[model samples]
Target: MRRSLPVDAAPPVAVGRGEAYENMRCDVCGSGERDEELLLCDGCDRGRHIFCLRPIAARVPTGPWFCPACAPRSKPVKRFPMTQTKIIDFFRIQKGAEDVEAEKCGIFQDVKKRRKRPLVMHKKRRRILPYVPTEDKVQRLKQMASLATAMTSATMKFSNELTYMPGMAGRSSNQARLEEGGMQILPKEDKETIELCRTMQKRGECPPLLVVFDSREGFTVQADADIKDMTFIAEYTGDVDFLENRVNDDCDSIMTLLLTEDPSKRLVICPDKRGNISRFINGINNHTLDGKKKQNIKCVRYDIDGESHVLLVACRDIACGEKLYYDYNGYEHEYPTHHFI
Candidate 1:
C-alpha cells in the first residue's frame, strides 16, 4: 500500500536575486506575457501569470516555484525485489481462497432458482469479558493501601507544628506579614546567611535559630522570629546558553526549576542536577493521604534592576520544624512524572 515519489531527475536550480530571467510563454496555458508581473519558473524558465496558476496569487512567492512540466513524477515503490515464482505463488493462494469461498456460497444455484433474497454471510459472535484482577495484583493493591495509611500517620505526626487557630482559616502568619509589607521583604542576611549562622552557633555566638533541616521533613523556614515572607531561599546560577543547549539536546532531567514562563527569556534554574540545601525541599502532591490540602510555598518572579530572579515565597504560615512543600506543576492534580527528579 505504500508508494514513494522518484528523486528529481534534474538538480534544483539555485534561486537568488541576480538570476537571468528568460522570455517565454506560460507552459500551462500556452499564453505569452511581456509584463513584469509574470512569475518565471526557476527550473524551466517558463513564465506563468499570477492568475493562471491553480492557486491564483497576487504576487511572486518568496522561494523558487516550478512549473508543472518541471515538477517530479511519482514512481511505484517496491520495498523488496520480488522473484517471479513468489509473485505467482501469492496470486495462486489468493485465487484459491476466493474460489473456495464462492463455491461454498453457491451463488450460481441461487441465481438459477430465481431467488431474490440478498446473500448474507453470518459471522460468529464473540463475547468479551471484563478483566479480572489477578491474586498478585490484589496483593499489590493491599500493600499500597497499607503504605498510604503509614505515610498519612507519619505526615500528621511531623506537621503538628502547624497549629490551627480560629478566625485564621487559610492565612498563615507569614502571609499576614507579607501583606503588611506590600508583598516585598528586604533580605536580613546576604547569600552566606545559613553558613554564617551555623558558624556563629558553633562558637556559641548567634541569635535564636530561624530555620533548620529535619531529616524526614527537609528544610523548614520558620516564622517564629518575625521572619518576613518572600525571602530569598537560594539560587542556581549557570550559563543561559549552556542550559538552552542541554534542553535542546533532550537533557531535561536536570531542569528542576522554571525561572521564566516566556520562551524569549533564557533563565532556567536546574537544582536537581546542582544546587544548595534549597533543592532538598520536597513538593506536595495534589492531595495528601489524609485528604488535607498542603501547599506552603510558591515560586514568584522577582526582578532586580533588569535582572530576573525566581524567589520562593511563603504563601502560608510555616511553623518551626514543619516540612516545606510547594506544588511543582503550579496546578493541582496534574503530576508530570518525567520532570520529577
Candidate 2:
C-alpha cells in the first residue's frame, strides 16, 4: 500500500535546510540554533550545516535537505568528455580567480572607491601654449598650392595623352620602359589572381550561407527569389544590434521577425516536431532572438526540416543566382565552434 505523510506532522528524519531544520535548535535537538553553519547544498546554493538535525541524516524525501554545518555531498555528477573538460577547466580557473577577487573586494565596494575619483585629471592652472601654424607664412602657402596645382595639371595632360580605346584602356607600350625605370602601374593579369579577385568581390565579407541536412535525402536547392516567387515574403530583416556588436556566432541572438504577413497563407511552423508550433516559435523567439521584434523579418517554410520551420534572412531580395542565407547567431562563443566553413 502507498503512504502519505500528514501535512501538519513533522518529518521522521529531516536532514536539510528547511523551516523545521531552521527553527528547531541543534543543541536542544528540537529548537533551531542561532548561528547556523553555512554549507553549500548539492545544487551549489546556500545551505545549512549537517549537525543541526535531530537524527543527523535524512529519511525525508520531499524537502531540499542539506546540512547547514557542512556542504551536502552526493556522488559527483558525470563530467564532459576530455576536450570539453579541458575547456571547462580553463574557464573555471579564470572564473575562480574572478570570484576570489570579488569576494576580497566585497561586491562593488572597490568599484565604488575607484569610481569616486575623477576619470580625467584636472589642472589647477590651465596653461595656454602659443599655437604655431604650419601655414604662418602666407606667401609660402600660396607658392606650395600653386606648385601642386601646376603639377596636377601636368599629370592630367600626360594621363590624357596615354588614354586609349576599349580593350587597352590603361596599358601602353611605354609601361615596359617605365617598369625598367622602377615604376609600376596596373599589374599584368594572372588567371589565378583574376579568379581570386572575382571570388572576393562576390563574397563581399558576408559569410557563406550554411544549409545543414540531418538526413541524406533532405531536399535542398540553391536559388534566389523575386518578390512574387517567394511563397512567404518577410521584408527588412537582420539584427541591428548583432551588427552593432560584431557578434557573428551561429547561436547569437538575432532581431525577431517584426511582421509575419503570410501573403501566400503559408502555415508558420516550428522546427520542433514534438511541441506545439506556436510554443516552439515562442521559445525560438524568446531565446534565439533575444525577444526584440522590430523591422527584422523572417519567413517560414513548412517542409524545410521535414517539419514546419521558419528561416531568418538578410533584408534585400536576393538575385536569381545568389546564395540562400540564414543568420548564424552566437552569444559569447568559443573559437573552434564558431569557425567559418
Candidate 3:
C-alpha cells in the first residue's frame, strides 16, 4: 500500500482552512454552529445558510451560506431618512410634546404669551395749544389761529366807500376788489408745516411755524409777524367764563382772534374794519358749519384784546359737531398710540 497518513497526524489542518470537523462559527448573531446542511459560509465559514441563524435572517438571502445576522445587516438598507427631514420632524414632534406638557401645566401659555406682549402703537402728536388764558378774555381762538396762518395771502386795492354802493357796478367793482384785494385764500403749505411741527412736538419740544406774507396783498398777519397799529375786532360770549381768563393771559394780541357770539348763533371776529377779514370762529357753534357734513371745520376762538389780533379763518367752512381747531398751536405726541391686533 502507498504510504498511509498517520492516524495521529492526518495532514495538519491548514491555518487558513480551519481544523477539519471544527465547525465554523455562525456570522449571524455569532450563534454557534447548529446546522450543517449548507456548506461552510464563504464569509462566515458557518455550515448553514445565513437565513437559519439570526432573528432577522428570514429577510436575508438564502442558498449562499452567510451568517444570518450578518446577511440581514449587510443587505442595503432602503428608504433612509433625509437628515433635514429627520431633524424637522423631530423638532415638530418635540414642539407638539412640549405643547401638550404646557397644556397639562394648567396655565394657558399660548394665551399668556400673547398677553405678555405689550400693545404698542404709533400715536400722532397732538399740537400744543397757545395757553388757554385764565385772565384777559379775548375770543375766537380758532379764528385767530387761522388768521395768523402765514400761508394765507391776499392782494388789496384802495377803493373808497363809494365803491361799495349796493346794486351799483361800484358794488360789483368792490366785490371784485374784495376778491382781488382781500386775503385771497393762499394755497396752504400747512400740511407739510403741520407735519414738521408734529414731528418736533413729539419730543416734548415746541417748534413754531414761522411764515412771511406779502402785506402788499391784503393785510397779512402771520403767527410771528410784528403788529403796529392794527385794530382787532373779535366776537364775545358772556357764557363760558373760564374762557375770559384764557384770553386775558394766554392770547397774544397779534396772534389771537376775539370771539363774539351773534344772534345768528355764528361766531364772528374781525381783524380790521373791512368785513373781508372777518373770521367765523364759531360757525359750527351756530350750525352755519355742519360738522357731520365735513369734519375739517370747527368753531374755536381764543379771545384777547388788541389792535393786532388776527382772526383765524377756517381752511374749509365748518358746521356744528366738528372738532374745533383751537389746539392747532402744538401738543405732546406719545409713541405707540395703539396696540396691533
Most lDDT-accurate candidate: 1
The TM-score of candidate 3 is 0.16
lDDT at 185 for candidate 3?
26
What are the Cα lDDT values of the candidates?
A: 0.36, 0.26, 0.26
Please give the ranking of all candidate structures by lDDT, highest first, separated by commas: 1, 3, 2
Give TM-scores for every candidate, taking all chains together and pairing residue i with residue i: 0.30, 0.17, 0.16
Under the 3 Å rule for N, CA and C atoms, how many clashes does model 1 have?
A: 1
Count clashes in each candidate, considering only residues at least 3 apart in sequence or on different chains: 1, 24, 52
Model 1 worst lDDT window (10 residues): 125-134
* Full ranking by TM-score: 1, 2, 3
Tens-place lDDT per residue, model 2, 1-341, is 00123345564454564564345333323323433333234343333323333322212222344443443553332332334334223222122333433332442364357458776776542211111112223332332233223223222111101122342212222122222222222222222222232232122211122111212211112222232222222222221111222222222123221112322211111111111111111111222333323212233322211222223333444443333333323221222211111
- The lDDT of model 1 is 0.36
All candidates: CA RMSD in angstroms? 32.7, 31.0, 43.0
Encode model 3's per-residue lDDT on 128-147: one tens digit a residue: 12211112112222322233
